[model samples]
Target chain A: MSDTLRPTDSQSPQPVQPLLARIKRRSFFMYAGATAGATALALAGCSKDETTPSSAATNVSFGTGDASVLNYAYALEQLEAAFYAKVAALTTSPLLAAEVPYFAKLATHEAIHRDFLRTAINRDFGGTIIPDLTPKFDSIDFTKRVKAATDTKLGILDAAKAFEDLGVAAYNGAAKLFKGSVYLGIAGQIVSVEARHAAYVRDLITPGSFATNEGTDVLGFDRQLTPTAVFAIAQTFVEQKLDASTIGQ
Target chain B: MNFFNIIDLLAEADPDVLDRFSSRRAVFNSLGTVAQRAALATSPLFLGALFQKAYAGTASLPTDILNYALTLELLEADFYRQFLAAGQIPAGAAFDAITVIKTHEDAHVAYLHDAVIKAGGTPVTGSSTAGIRFNPSLLPATYADQLKYAQVLEDTGVRAYKGRAAELIGTDLLTPVLQIHSIEARHAAHIRTMRGQQPWVSIGDDLAADANYKAAYTSGVASSTRTTVALGGTTYGIPAFNPAQPSPQESNLQQGAAGTKLALLITTGIGSTTYLPDDAAAAFDEPLQAAEVLDSSRAGGLLA
Candidate 1:
């Protein structure tokens, strides 16, 4: 693996280069900006008072090759890590004292995973890692143990399940794109953990419901969602239009 | 001669270089006669030709794979039933759990077999007259021995199913296969925890205790410790990592080749372990040629 910790300074701040080598860099950026602006305008029009930060307005682009997949994972991890971190920072009612440490540990794990992907892409792919995602959790009520009519409902357990389930399906869906066995093995390891997390969270929702047919299909595999399918669900949490056309680019 | 020397040598080598060497050595060591047969059967570059033939069509549908998969579940069901009937499982909560698990396996077999027939495939039938028994030579002599063996069997089953999930994806049978796979993982986890292992720790967890635990289960000896296995002068050990405190690569096992030479040691004697059972091989799970399952009397051991 490349040295992900010490990202090359030259590649840090430059705006993302379009994947097509023949396209003029300036024209590509202009097109991306226009597309993003249009998307943001449409989003703004839909929710006039929505307080989505301007920083979260960029178009989600996959750079090239495996880095794109990594970024996809990174983005999901960002949503998850952020939610868990918030949960860990703010305690809620009916919080089992023993479960607090577990959530904290999950937060740390997600942070590490997020950083690891960022560093790997920076070091190996020589690209600017996608910026830290700002989640739109304005709707979630972190203060309520149960979902209140007023709150967004994006808590630790809910976020964990969504992220874990999405992560498993994403990896499963994307595993075919990876030509390298090393990548596949790494994916295999990650998905199993994701599956474990899925099981744990499923059990949390309903005890012993972890490995049942209800969540997974008949073959005992986790439900796999196509990129388009997952992005539809994820777009709710993120402010940006994740352009996954270049996913396996 | 020592652990440090081995680590030093391994540390200097790049991952790809090590991977290549491991692959080549695995071919020469394990694929000896079979490799020769495969080579002779096809033109030059037989391996590529073989893969081309194997993955020829998208027609390797989920239903077809599941029909074949039902065979594996049936085999496990038979194995557990025989073990139960032979009074192999110890009398305790463990035994009660094993009985419950056996019933689940039976249910899985029935479900899969029914699905297979529904999908226009033959329902796999195990022999009532031709009983398939565990290798008495490899099994433990006591009740704890039985528990350890069952634990390892279930754990291996869990990994095996998971390892094949990708191939089954996008098939009609994907849901059923995934359902079974998760249950198998759950069963493996429950059995492992019953054997004084952590409930959350997967058998594939590359932790220090994992190796020790695997060794104990395979060998039926509590004194077994985590140790590296030597293959062609290279040693591989399960590295320890806490899931809650994952390292950079701890969350993912670093990728290797599509087919790398990784030895799965199954303890045969008190200390010596062998490879996984022949029936456990991926080739056996696929539809076999006439020569593959020639024994009419031993159909239970082969098909079901």
Candidate 2:
């Protein structure tokens, strides 16, 4: 995919190299220790981000000013696009048959967001765009719709909700950082659509819980987390550590 | 008439009345000395809601933008209140959910009101419902009509905030406006879900198919004459957009600049999904001019 599953960013072979290595390492581990028939379980169990010690060294700086903000959004969209792609590609998806269409829609929407940001950033800032991010969805179980509280890995819906809600807050807090009105306007356009996605996913999880606490704050205001706070949560799901310092400054 | 209904009445009276400085611009421009005297001594009587709404508390404070925002919030909040009272919504989940939305809207009204007053400007007061707008009798007297209207209002809320958000970018109010904007989208999505429609805006998501709700999908943008906006002691202007095309409607697949529209539509082969023009349209929600928010078929048509 242009947006995910591979690196098609401004940086060519560099971004692709690490991602390929990560998957290859997991493949070797599964074949050497586990049997051939247990491939799915082996990949899920042994492919956690912790196994990749090189991840911490792969920290990405999103650059300064509007470049940083655009990169911040691009990084998130990358993670989301990758996650939904895996979900949609699931051979043994635990998600309901009726709910499959929603994931498909989410997959395309996220890819569009990711690719659009890439196109915009590369067009506007040229060489300053960040390298393609490697999404670490090892902690998500595509075979489960919702996981137990004690489970380390999340189900499909849990991860979707988290990504959508995180996306909404991220845009709200970062949009004002943009100096240009057109960019800010575009950010507004995308964030509301993200909110819509979040609400629909929330309803799927709980009948009438759309736009609840996870989406809105106490005063009925929607959640607006700063980039620093957002990056903290995002760093857990991605192989790269993103530093949002000086964004929109 | 309830206290807030008067705001809707005026919104219905002038479809181009935005978050509106056009009619009030020449009037406000002449009030260079309003800071030195009473608004009543200088302004005419016809400028009622907007006059006080824009120049409510004091003349020295710059709060026309915030006042415009407050005007919309008050209108939506009152509409929800009246709709809840009409008993058209189903009980259990549907009623509970709409009530939750109404609560958030009311909270927005309170917060925006205080924000205006805190900026050293008088907050616009709500008026009686006697001469209120938002005609409730035009529908088929059904719950589906109620939900559809709510969907239109919520989507409009999202677009309205997006339209004026750039004006408040330099100020501290941008995030709050954005935060509220998303919440409105959430409300829109939930209502659309109840109606069994796609959660996000799509090309087929036509509110105008019924003909009566034509204004909901109608397009408008800030006029070239009103391009510059003043905020926080600095004047900010909109970036260059095609005057030939202006603001695109909900069904528009083109985003950002024309040069980048194709790039934004990149499908990239994710799970055999080739995104069409409609997906591009649904991915982004365009802004509606604050000057052209209400129209005969949109929110204005509901005005009594």
DockQ of each: 0.13, 0.34
Candidate 2 lDDT score at position B172: 90
DockQ of 1: 0.13
What TM-score does chain A reach in every model? Answer: 0.74, 0.77
Off by over 4 Å in 2: A1-56, A214-216, B1-62, B127-133, B138-140, B206-208, B221-245, B258-274
Model 2 chain B worst lDDT window (10 residues): B231-240
TM-score of each: 0.55, 0.74
Over the stretch B1-304, how does candidate 2's per-residue lDDT look in tens digits? 3212443565454322333443444544654575532443433453464456653322222366666566667667767777788888888998999899889888887888788778877555453253332454654467888778888888888888887787675679888878888989999999999988899988777565667666677675333334343322333232333346445688776666622234243343222346687788788888876545644445544555
lDDT of each: 0.50, 0.71
Question: Which lDDT value does model 2 have at B5?
Answer: 48
Best by lDDT: 2
Which candidate tops TM-score?
Answer: 2
